[model samples]
Target: MVKGYNYIVNSFFDYLENRSKAVDSLLCVGLDPHIQHLDKPSAAAARDFCLEIVDSCAKYACAFKPNSAFFEVFGAEGISALREVISSIPEDIPVILDAKRGDISSTALAYSNAVFQHLGADAVTYSPYLGSDSVAPFVRRPEKGVFILCKTSNPGSNDVQILESNREQIYLHVARQSLVWSKHNNIGLVVGATDPYALTRVRDIAPNSWILCPGVGVQGASLKDALISGLRKDGMGVLITVSRAISGESDRAAVAAELCDAINRERESRKQNHTVHVTNNIAVDLIETGCVQFGDFTLKSGQQSPFYIDMRRLASFPDVLNRVSKEIVKKVLDLRFNCIAAIPYAGLPIGTAVSLLLNKPLIYPRRETKEYGTKSSIEGVYKSGETAIVLDDLISTGGSKFETINSLQKVGLNINDIVVLIDRQQGGRKLLDSQGYRLHAVYTISELIDEWLAFELIDNNQFILIKNYLSESA
Candidate 1:
């Protein structure tokens, strides 16, 4: 086995991300030794064909995907050749076996062994149609990666993937469910580049997850368009998979190098063109959704204020809620938390959206414990000694958070971090820090006010009022 492959298997995505940066490419080379393209229809010919491709293009490749069906056609010899090709890949480059295997849990376990142990693939793609049990075996090995087929590149994908469930597309449902299944942080989505709309929708739902996008070249998908629609804010989550376009070329290495350069150029262009800050987008959405209102208002703490931020309105605007959730997910990605603990009332919707996006279990402290049933102080399933990251719409004096924190601690849950959409700059962070907890906010109240003023959404008087209010409170 390659050195440290076993050790790094647990963090396959991290390995892939590092490899992508080292090579400065998101190109995932596809090794499909087609019978017609081979000199002879034999396993030896297939092995040689792939070895040449790897030897020529390994430096330019972020990862290599070998379609198992092409090799499996040759039976035992083909399987042997497949193993040889994977073992020959460089230690840093991840190999994804496009097996698309789907079966019951027991049968899936055997399949996992064959692909991960026998063939030695770093990751494998499988169908999620059979539900979680069928996929349990593959994802159970947290070190190994699994990509669930979401929106495929094929034309017929629309027949079923577009079907609506609860007013949302089936593919989107899979994207949401993929988050829940990614508790190990080892799961990704396989989205075809041919459908940029589908790719965009998937990106919106799972902004931080790695998406393997096929159909970039011979399949007639535009690489630039796919990157524009599918790339994460950091510009590193989308992998462009190409098979015939690179392997079929006489000068494979040159084609691979050109493709890599082209992809980088597009990434750079997107970065340059992305002028609007993420918080700016949220600020506009907040205004349009009426979450942020100006003029005289009474604060919950009985203090008079020139404006009020009613984040509860987010639940009424699903699109705005989704956009906000995506940003929150980005902040939560680097934190260590067993689940989410949303402060009740305004925090529930925001927390629920964040929970769905991060695939983390969500629990909340009810304002009043129900007298009937279990009468538990906290809702949702959780275990003692687990860390909980507190979620809320906004934080002001940091007083309300302690109420929920105290309730959570009463149940033996550990609280180390709190995330919110906006920090009102009223000593909330200081209060939290003094209490042995960290606060993470997507935007400070001052930043939001500045954004609104810059966009001409708020007048100078309104901006000044909010700014003074924040300063006085601080």
Candidate 2:
């Protein structure tokens, strides 16, 4: 568990290394299973062919990405075939269910559950144009992941994705927004290898993000240019995907192996490409960790807030927790605080994570002191005359803010800066500022509400209601 995770290695890294291992074995077969290519001319046959390809390629390829539409054509039978095909593959080689689905809350939840549970996918693809609600369900689960569509290998993708806006390509908008989404979930970008420029721009926006790049083989995207455009400074961010050129041929296993070799060669060619500014990569990661939330909820001040934040969710998601903790530490790199204290159970995990990552001592005040031990309200390493940061997931009226600060002060810690994950902006910031405590927040409920509104994730009435509530609360 590097920092705090059950998995020793990162999922993306594992997928990459797993591919490398499979390449050494010589296999990366694409399970397209077009009905025209199948001998039996049935959904079950398609499934059987896919499983056969997996059986043949598992020894050669590290992972399999199954395009959903191929099986969707068969209706219920096709869906069953798809499920069986997924389950038939060797468990060691991860499966990427390539279903580019994007929808709102309930619908998105059904899609996510279908992909992760019914289809048994390690990860699935998502379209981010709908806003956060569409993408939240996948990330909420600890094991699953979401790969966002930034740019595609398809020529028609340029029709909308590459159109100019503010001198920035439409694809760049997708890339930048995906960066924000990636902060909270295991977000990666799907940038086709065919467009080097678009790929580079996506990389610029998300340097640390793993790219699942298609068009490497059949689409005529050169291994040379892809290596040049796709490789990150670390050499591991690019997942060069090839489908037809490898899968369309006889000796599917041998072709898969050859493709893997081709990817490795490309990776070696672009080994020296330096990474660009990815300042918000880790911050976005924090948001994805289920540690961040954006929705309507009542605050302690009896005010209806635009969004509610709960960073404690990070404790259950290691990737998100680590990403957010690291980013928070990066944001506070220059600041000096004598002690770290969280607002009871909610903020304790983040506080502890930051404290450990920064090598700074930690002290969290409890809602109430324990009856046993030191009978102290504060725990861990605390000291006198030291300045402290009050850590809380969300702040509403700044009512509890004083209570938390006072508790820390009682233990001889100086209280000033309050680091909150979300600021309801319903007097919390103003209240903290009036008390001479600088309020730092990752995001505001209003900002989140605006995002929801812009994406049409919520109705105008909900937006107006939230606005009226905040205005009335203020």
Candidate 3:
């Protein structure tokens, strides 16, 4: 096995973000299986065609972005074949469902479930024009991922994305506004490699965000130049998508290998590039990740709750983790803690990402430290009496937070503040207040519901049900 490949990659984002490093390549096979490219009209043949390409090029790919339109054209049978095609992909390789779907609230959510749950897609492409309500369902399920259509390599993309709006190009506004929807930090943008202006501007707006660059093959984008403009300072940020260039070749794997090596060489040629500031739209991200849910769920309190909240889903999204860490870094830098600690189970990734982002040390609290390894409840180095901020993904009854906080205090790590992604408002805030600690959160349940109502994601009865439940629970 390859060096990093020996270890388990847990999520779609983790695989795509690290595969380039693991395999030393960034070539992603774009599985656009047009019927014209095949000899038989059989759905099984189409499935076989994609499987062959994957078998040929899977080793060279960081991910596979199969345009849903192609499979969609085949109707029900084609859809079944698409599922088989998706299942055929290796577990460690992320698949992006390139379906630029955009609609409002619950409708968008149904689409979100279709892509992430039913289809089992690791990530999907979406149009952002319907605004936050339309995108929230996708963003809310932040464990899965979304590549918002920012700028494309096609000729007619200028009709809207590039047109001037509010003294700026519409695409920049889209890039800027995306952060608001990326709360769980799982958001990415799609910019065609052929569009130089967009490639440059989007990076400026979302410096730390990943840009999926298409239009590299038959679309005539300069791969070298696109990499130069698009790569993050680490040279690994952008996903360089080369579809036809590799697919049309007689030796598809050979072509992908060559392109992979070329892209790696180009990225290495410019390692000094700086990373960007990342911001997220928490409501959208939380919803996309399935951290926030509507309908009946029984709470640990023995009461039925209308909404279920959990932010552990955030760990699966590398892009969202990066953005959330960047946001947390901004808040924590001012606090100037000597180290960072996280409550185990959910907050581990968020805390680790923040620690790396801040260049500080990290320690995670175990429910009980391993009897085998240092026999201490807390792992990692920390000085006694040193200050550290706590990271957790959500606060419901504050049941988990207090336990972890007490453990941190026992170690002499002074923590008077805790940061979380969501404040469910079901006595979590008051519980912290009673303890003389402040709760900092990216979004509260009230804010999320308002967004849902505004976008008509929930009807009056549904909205009233949620609000009244929270009100009574409070």
Candidate 4:
């Protein structure tokens, strides 16, 4: 048993991470197998239900959690169905036995053996009330994990969990104590999504510990709140369990994929939102510093715009321009290109700044090839097969950038991506994508304007006026 436990420990975390990537999902499907939810009244029907769910959603799940109470109520047949369901799951994706068994010493030992040895579950949920000794047997293996029920999903959890102890709440004490108990790094907490407030506290208490988050679907827990609070620093390590949410659906696999995508989008949105706020703050400062102007300004396209941003004036503020240049260079360097080229007039200074900062060669692609002095379209010592990232101040309808792309491609420069200070969102992205190029921007005009309005830099009428103009232009 000890030998087998060591093997399970060796593969658990790695298996979880690898399987999650393979499945392209972090949702853990819970197999509770309640009798009424089954198509038929018999235990075989229950077994088939669980089997079908595992078969369908296994490829879209990181783990499968089987709650023991739902199975044990039916006695032997229920237990048999549970065993068959666990055995049917893919070996790489772990199965956590959600048995909230709470006992210390010898009793904990026997339960641990039943869960790990007899049943073949990689992890189990156990009560932490009995202290470290209760969970010691389970952690002795180091590969398997034990999730303590800190602040559960139900409303009744506060009855005992929230009771004050040593001037700290009992739940907080249990949350903090899990760290001391986590000698092997196998400690986790069963934080209910319903109690996002408590879940948040527990997460802070054990940032690196795995959190098995339930109550997302049937329990009506806030998915947004759970994601904001429960995610570990790497944007993962939260096992979201949904039983009826995935299983009850006719298209369970599609539903699982949607949920998985939503979870990842939420994580990504956090990082993106932080960047937008930071960059938007910079844009606001640039405007206040006279680099950008907010008024009726006629753009080069002969269209009236409420705001005008000029990259040339960035030189007026060295401290801000230095930060802006660093940001632009960092983004351009990420492209891993040999050099950078910009559109003639507006993009010259920004492109030169990026090139000098990144220590890369710079080129300015002319509208037409020069009649003399090399008679070249692109003015740079670039060669064929060498890549160049396009730098531009802003994109409007993308016509100018499109012209630059064509001229570069005609002269033998590789341009697969463009870095812009702002995207006008006037159908430029679609055009760029159609030409097999990616347009990475610090902000879209709409995104910047929205930030301006949010920060009260623009009045409601001004905001509405810009929105109306954008609609008319589109």
TM-score of each: 0.59, 0.53, 0.56, 0.59
Candidate 3: how large is its RMSD? 22.8
Q: How well is each residue in 1-474 modelled by candidate 4, as lDDT tens digits?
A: 212222444435655666676766779899877778878766677779888888888878889998887777778887787787788887777888999988987988999998888787888998988788888998887768788888898889988999998899998899899889856767788889887667767776777777899999988987876876677757787888899998889999998888988998887875565455545367677667776687899988898888777877766666776676777876665577888888777678778878888889998887777888888878878888788898887887877787887788887778899988888778888888887999988878877775664455664456556765777887
- The deviation in Å at residue 457 for candidate 4 is 21
- Which of the two candidates, 3 or 4, achieves a greater lDDT against the reference? 4
| Angstrom error at residue 228, model 2 | 1.4
Could you say which candidate leads in lDDT?
A: 1
Q: After superposition, how far is residue 181 of candidate 4 from its true place, in Å?
A: 1.1
C-alpha lDDT (0 to 100) for residue 344 of candidate 1: 75
In model 1, where do residues sit more than 4 Å from their true spots? 1-10, 275-474
Candidate 1: residue 126 lDDT (0-100): 90
Residue 194 C-alpha lDDT in model 1? 89
> Runs in model 4 with CA error above 4 Å?
1-11, 274-474
